[model samples]
Target: MNPPDVAAAVVVGGLFAAGCYLLLQRTLMRLLFGFLLLGHATNLLLLIAAGSPGAPPIIGAARIGDEPSADPLPQAMALTAIVITFALTIFLLSLVYRSRQLHGNDEVRDDAEDRRLAENQQREASAAAADPHRTNGSGQARTAADEGGNTL
Candidate 1:
């Protein structure tokens, strides 16, 4: 209802929107960023839902009838969320690093073309190796074929 609350809500909404957009990207880095943003947005939403800070939730026996204390539930929830997010981020970063190391690239691409080309090349190579008369280029196979009969 207040200006600060409205601003927080807007920021939370913006972060969620940004996270969704980044998650749709084809790069691992973008996806990591999206997850981070989403985590932050969730924390912000929890904070906004929790009332503003006042006093600690501790109460003495004699001060039991004093005033209401700050709610610790949201704060605890936020802390737990933060810890979980940290773990997730670390795991995701490791995955991204491993992927880049293995593939030499971070972007997700269709491997159908590459696989097809490799398979075609393999088939061609096998065919060439199988044919005795079809000597592959430079001397070696040609010499062997020449020594043998001119048979197919």
Candidate 2:
């Protein structure tokens, strides 16, 4: 391969790496940007691999005995890729918008407090199910007073 082709490959590879890194981020915008970068990197790699341009790939009486024309397969493939990427970009953008609207935030984060609360609730529910109406000696539901008034 030529120097230009090698450079293109390197750049495309770098873009792909960056895209992959960005895609792992929690933010939806970063994910969308990563996807867009990945699409461009793929298109660039395809273009570089197709070789330099020459004559059009058209068969006519004027060139019946000429050398092989430029291959349009890569170009066609790139076009299809671009169209698909565009559609995906639109879909992803819409998804990001909907997520932002519903969550009121774009960055994804774990709701630790919510998870803890849910776990506690589940524990309490299971305890209640196991002992429906088992009251302590003081006729109260296991309070600090029953445990010698040691505030937690």
Candidate 3:
């Protein structure tokens, strides 16, 4: 097959870039739109990879000196991709719906556990700074005199 057209390549790249940007957003709606865009882009790429369209590969439909019979593999793959995209889109839609119902918004919120963990780490760091090398695991620094006056 001949080399791909520059315009088609640019369009596919643009679609993928835009879709990734949207998918990284905090809102479900934007993510859904991105998913759809990516799906379309994938379908277009597959069809383009199949090369210029030709008559279906039929035993009796062969024409001399005409376009080479089209390969059905890419077409079949593209069709399967379309179906899978549709199914995943539906799943994402349901997730968006459930998120809205539970949180009253489509925007994903930061996880509380993550914030708590950060706070704990900060507190531990401050404590470590305040008491460097205090080994007994107590607020009061360990001392030989304090250990029953051993004084060793």
lDDT of 2 by residue, 1-152 (tens): 43566678889999999999999999999999999999999998888778876577876635645555777899899999999999999998998999899999888766666655555556556667778776442234334233432422
**What digit string (tens of lDDT, one per residue) describes model 1 on residues 55-103?**
6776653444555677889989999999999999999999999999999
CA lDDT scores, all candidates in order: 0.79, 0.78, 0.80
C-alpha positional error of residue 27 in candidate 1 after TM-score superposition, expressed in Å? 0.6
The TM-score measured for candidate 3 stands at: 0.70
**Leading candidate by lDDT:** 3
Pairs in steric clash, model 2: none
Instruction: Put down candidate 3 lDDT per residue, 1-152, tens digits, no spaces.
Output: 56677788889999999999999999999999999999989998998898777778777875868768887889999999999999999999999999999999999787766655555456556657877676344333223224523422
| RMSD value for candidate 1 | 10.7
Candidates' TM-scores? 0.64, 0.64, 0.70
- How does model 2 score by TM-score? 0.64
Error of 2 at 88 (Å): 1.0
Superposed model 3: Cα runs more than 4 Å off: 62-65, 118-152
Q: Can you give the lDDT of residue 75 in candidate 1?
A: 88
